[model samples]
Target: METVDEVDAPQVRQCPECGATVSVHARFVSWCAACDWNVDPGAPDPDRGRLAAYRKRLARRYGQQLAEEIERSGQEARRVGPDGSTVLAFGVSLLVHSVSGGLLLAAGLLIIGGWHTRILPVFGIVLLIAVATLLPRPGRLPKGAPVLYRADAPRLFELIDEVGAAVGTTGVHAVALDTAHNAWVSTYGIRNRRVMCLGAGLWEVLSPQERVALLGHELGHFANGDVRSSFVMHGALRTLARWYYFLVPHPLDSLLDLCVNTLVFLPRWAVYGLIVLLDGLTLRASQRAEYLADAGAARAGSTVAAVTLMDRLLIGDAVEAHLRRASMTAPEASGGSRGREAREAAERELWERLAARIGSVPESEYERLRRVSARRGHSVDDTHPPTHLRRRCLASAGPHPARVVCDASRTRSIAAELAPARARLARTVIRYNAD
Candidate 1:
């Protein structure tokens, strides 16, 4: 038996049954030249078949489990684990539950009272600030920036247009390959309403079928309001943080700071315990939201493709996460960073030399910079969680909540259903604020 990655050419050996030359590479077993003895190739074929079946069975089971976990959590804001234990994120912040009407009323009264008393202009200024906060945040992409949907190849502009149409949400304004192995849409432009291809690395590794699932996953975000909810949360966070900062006056800032430092700098064990409690609770709802997004993808495209993409995303995510974690310890990635550029250059050279040795990369004088990229990314404290953690959110998933009977017509049907909603929302949002 030979591996696809390792084997070079057909192996020739004397037949065990007779002193005759026999050639074997894949499952095929040719007739021995001397003895003319033919062997059944079905043996290897069945074993391969069995292995394929087993892999598929396991993949589906894992997918189902992960899906179940997500659906359970998404609907209830609880992390329902294998043992049936339910944990939660820190108690829902007042932001999640605050009634807009109440907040507006309070804001209105504050403004009027300030004017009535002829007080400082702070209250009216605050109300105006609050209104501004309500606007949706957009992703960060310039207009029609070229996106390398995948390394070595770019998804056509028309395909992106088609996908945006299917989602019936904001169309992709710019495509950028994310450094991570997974794919996502980042809000770009004004208030982050524009979508950016957040998965350049992912597109690099995934097959076309798997990429469709990845696309569908983004579509899930569109369908499930994940994007909208994220912006809403951002506004809420901004609003609360503003209030907290506002309340901490110059006089009290010192005392408040002291208390925060003391609590945070407590015994290592104590701090860790507190963080775990908060994190565990927060993960519950966050995990659940992930499932709804998964379900959204399944409903949007072929389920089989979705599953396939997830599997690739899982395995590849491991490598990406390793690089990401390493980045945390890695020196800062800048021209000033010591040896960072040199180290990356060295790695790139090694891979390129190997690729050239294997004919994987084209030959050119400038081929050295051909597809130049650092496998390691900067560890910026961004909204996205760690790569491995994000991967588990999908890789360890269970069955899709709704089974998709994928067919030629399925794409059109899904697109049609989403188009009207996307158009209406686009128009309304264009008129209204993004958030």
Candidate 2:
């Protein structure tokens, strides 16, 4: 007796463009094996705004350039130092910081001399308020996200520490769990303590090894000396953005207001120009850092695991679509109920449904996504290299054995430790979707 799988198996067909054999799956995209015809049927349109379009072009250009350089020079592309562009980025950053400092100094001088001239104090106070508003502060974890310390998640921390050691960085000081479909490492507090934010959506879908690869990639940012992530450079960029926000013209109500806006126009635009220049200068280096981090992912998890991780990232849109669909249908599914009971039911089913959705994705779909990525020059964002380029770089670097393994025992233990955070994130996701 033929089972459903055998009866519904994919049929092989000849490609119209290249006369190559292709498998036509019932529920997945089919493209030419040789010519990539129909690989990206819905080709991405140009980004909406001129600046956004420019950024996309710049990312694609630099991504390809870095890939070519890596191919030509092999290991030389991984070396980190203050290259001319980096030096200039830092110089521009320092100039912005100096302007902030000069304003602070002027405010201090005016306040100190206020006893001799009363009006000086009011102006000093105003300048102080401006400085306060513009001062750059370290990022904070999301207010309602589940924050975990070492005591709370010992096993999870152990896994992260192992990955971090493999990547040659001090491990994260804390972990925060959220409902996002992304994960990132960020610094918080005056001491610059590292915090790794694990998105439950992404975390729940990944295998144990892929989780390690994710950690390796993020920790690699710290190990690889990415200048853009550093305190001084990041703070300077933030300060400049703040300055531009305040200096930019507003709606004019009177002749005096128009005059003031006109007076500040040059300085406002100048600040904007500096922000663009600094961003452009450091962007290439940041993209290089991302490739290096992908290497770190391969090192910590085996090359196969790292490659699969990238494939998983390619399916993020699919995952998001699934989530959206699930969220939208939750009300309909729950006997048309609303509020706490319905949300609780959705929360209970969210992770399981996501896992099933991701697992059900056919092999052909992954292949189609890979081809589409190559055709579209797909990227995570402007800051990172294209996904296809990163995957290719990992493949070219040869197979790497896992330096930090996440065996069944450790995996189970880590899951046990993360149970609370998982539940918290699930509730958050359900509530957010309901709203």
Candidate 3:
């Protein structure tokens, strides 16, 4: 179909279906009302098959490139940093802390020794103040305190272990299930043990094959050593940030804070600037790590299944948002067994509604979403590359083919085991908001 150059003529467009000059909306021109022709000739909407094939190719290429980059990073760390980049970062941090601490100690000792006679009381008070201000406060722990639940699902654990083995990583040591529509593999404890967190909502939407793909992707992070490297960088950066924030005095909350803030501001700012510089330097590598993980997922399952899992996530997120908005308008929960049952029923209804919404989305709509997500690209704050990019990377996944970890019946059984917790969590949301 022919299209219109409405960017230059926003107010009017000649419809392709009918030769009528239809009035345009002046925004993202949806369609001509006169003949219902699509007026906004945006991106080139390629045919579905070609687009899918292109995506697969991109995924494969990205995955290969990522593997190479990760290998190089490991080699580079060994060559340049000796003990590794993370260790070097920590060593530098320790040196900085020690120097600052020593200086503070020296200052206190000199003040007390010099003012031992007449000005001792006043000097002691002054010294105490100096010590308090100069001392670096403990760094704040990472926020977004994850709601961790026991990953007591035996079948789920076995699946994770199998995926980990396939991906060539020391398998996940701990598992947590949370409410969000996401999944990740991370480290915890002094030993830096691996923990995999699965979003219960995400699990509900994924098929058995999709679940394997998802697990593979998470486990892949460990295989690529993304978690371990990031940990060191984060620790160093957090230490600097903590010192910066802590230096700003609190009692007055304004004027005193401002004065202290000024005194420590320049050094703190330098540290922050350094963190930003480091992030900028490492951003591309981090993104590559994500692509490699997706490749790993494609290996565990089929490329199509991996991509489908990502596609469903876009719709699943929308579903969650819709359910939340609906819950806000729900009637207040009465404190009784009957009311509790009613609220629980409403929660269940919302979940069904969510699943239905996801199922109802057209293939064309999904394609459109892929286009938009790809176009948006990755932001500075984003650790993973954009979904479209990841999809493209997986397209080239030839080495990793589909491997079934669980049958349909086993998946259903696993779902049943976790169903009670998810249900309770859903009902809790409804009840909590009712008040």
The candidate maximizing TM-score is 2
Mind sharing the TM-score for model 3? 0.67
Give the poorly placed runs of model 2, Cα more than 4 Å off. Answer: 1-30, 43-52, 74-77, 112-120, 248-261, 331-345, 432-435
lDDT of 1 by residue, 1-435 (tens): 644334534567777778766665432335454544553222221223432343333333433454455445553112233222221221223333254446566667777766667553467667657755643355456333334332222234344444444544444554553344555666655655545464434554544445555665675556545421455544444444444334332333687777655554544334334333333333333434455555445434444555545444424423444344433433333544445565454433332232222232112111211111011111111222222333334444444432323344544543343333333322221222122
Q: What TM-score does each of the candidates earn? A: 0.40, 0.87, 0.67
Q: What local lDDT score does residue 94 receive in model 1, on the 0 to 100 scale?
A: 38
- lDDT (C-alpha) at residue 199 in model 2: 81
Please, what is the whole-model Cα lDDT of each candidate in the order they appear? Answer: 0.42, 0.82, 0.59
Clashing pairs in 3: 56-395, 58-392, 58-393, 59-392, 59-393, 59-394, 59-395, 60-393, 60-396, 299-400
Candidate 1 stretches greater than 4 Å from native: 1-139, 142-155, 164-170, 189-193, 227-230, 238-289, 296-301, 316-318, 321-435
Between prediction 2 and prediction 3, the one with superior lDDT is: 2
Candidate 2, residue 317: CA error in Å?
1.4
TM-score pick, better of 1 and 3: 3
TM-score, candidate 1, is 0.40
